[model samples]
Target: MLGASTWNADRAQEIVDEHLSLEAPMLPILHALQEEFGYVAPEAAPLLAQALNLSRAEVHGVISFYHDFRHEPAGRHVLKLCRGEACQSMGSEELAEDLFTKLGLDWNRTTRDGELTVEPVYCLGLCASSPAALIDGEPIARLDATTLGEAVDEARGL
Candidate 1:
């Protein structure tokens, strides 16, 4: 997993301040916070709102709207399965369901061992390789349950 630091209000404030000069600082601030802390700390919303002269709701809205912005830290390995029409048509859904069951996880949930977090992505631009997935951002095309399982195991160092 990425070595994200523990949440610190002071550090978060500094990050917000650093980007205050930008024309559109909200996204940058949020990304910075996530980069530092793995996920945007809930406490950050108010700090961002106050710094940017925006409502807390607005800050939160942006956070929630972006699928890439995780509310909680992800597991050591993140498996992003493509769920676009092509992938779905190619049986990604079935493969995903089997993997989810095996891992005892639901979408966006982490495994009990913290080894993996499974997420659904809209597209990976690998339609020709439908049923693709990304393991820690490394694309795996032509995915099957066995291949996906092996990838996850390898990522877990099993």
Candidate 2:
């Protein structure tokens, strides 16, 4: 039961039940939980474990192994920067670091004011337009640090 968060156990149980009939239902169940709750509530691991008759460790492993299943609620805006090789070659790493430095954000952390959350994604399929970002789900490519900062600022409405 996710007592402290916006999520509740009843909803978690509903989501688990809805996906239980599928083969290897864990993935779908996790996805549904994230979609409904903004993140997979930590309380959900036990609920899911009980429903699937799995150990909590197994459920937790899947959540940790997958980058998309955010453990905490994201801020009002999300910045998913590409960290794949192609993007790195185009200076995505440096640009991302600059933004992190400027914003005082670490990987998967929200800002102190809860305005933005930045996470790394292995790929956004924008390799051809390397050095890419998805800011609030809008694609911005061919990024220099200044350009990236500008895009982030724009996306954040700053």
Candidate 3:
């Protein structure tokens, strides 16, 4: 997770202008916003709507529909666990619960200290080694509690 976005009208306008020329600018604009900010701000919807001549609801829908789009800021380190069928069969569901308990946080929630955030991802294409997870964007296959906890600890600088 990059840091929380510093939401500013000027920055938003600049981003909007940069992508306004694309044939389908919504995705590009949103992606650019996310790239600059950790997630898109709520205010961005209205700005995007005005630029595209669409309703704010339509802009909101597009952002919400994309699983990758984060409405809120993520923690310093993001842990995306696979929830695909292969991983589920390999006990990822159980692992997810275990992590939730260990981290004392549910999916899409950040830790109190904002050191780590746990989120669900459908697949990482690591079926051969199921129960995969991406720790700070680094893919890990055959995930287990011990490894994940260790990584989390490391990520949090514990």
TM-score against truth, every candidate: 0.92, 0.87, 0.92
Candidate 3 per-residue lDDT over residues 34-146, each given as its tens digit: 88888898999999999999999999999999988888788989999999999999999999999898779998999898888899999888998998999888888877888
The candidate 1 region of ten consecutive residues with least summed lDDT is: 1-10
lDDT of 1: 0.89
Write model 2 residue lDDT over 21-108, tens digit each, in one string: 8998999998888878888889998998898899999889989998788787888788889999999998887887888889888888
- State how far residue 136 of model 3 sits from its true place (Å): 1.6
Cα lDDT listed for each candidate: 0.89, 0.85, 0.88
Candidate 1 ranges with C-alpha deviation above 4 Å: none
lDDT of 3 at 105: 93
Which has the higher lDDT value, candidate number 2 or candidate number 3? 3
Q: Return the clash pairs for model 2, or none.
A: none
CA shift of 55, model 3, Å: 1.6
Candidate 2 wrongly placed segments (more than 4 Å): 1-5
Q: Write the per-residue lDDT of candidate 1 for residues 116-135, one digit (tens) a residue.
A: 88889999999998899999
lDDT of 3: 0.88
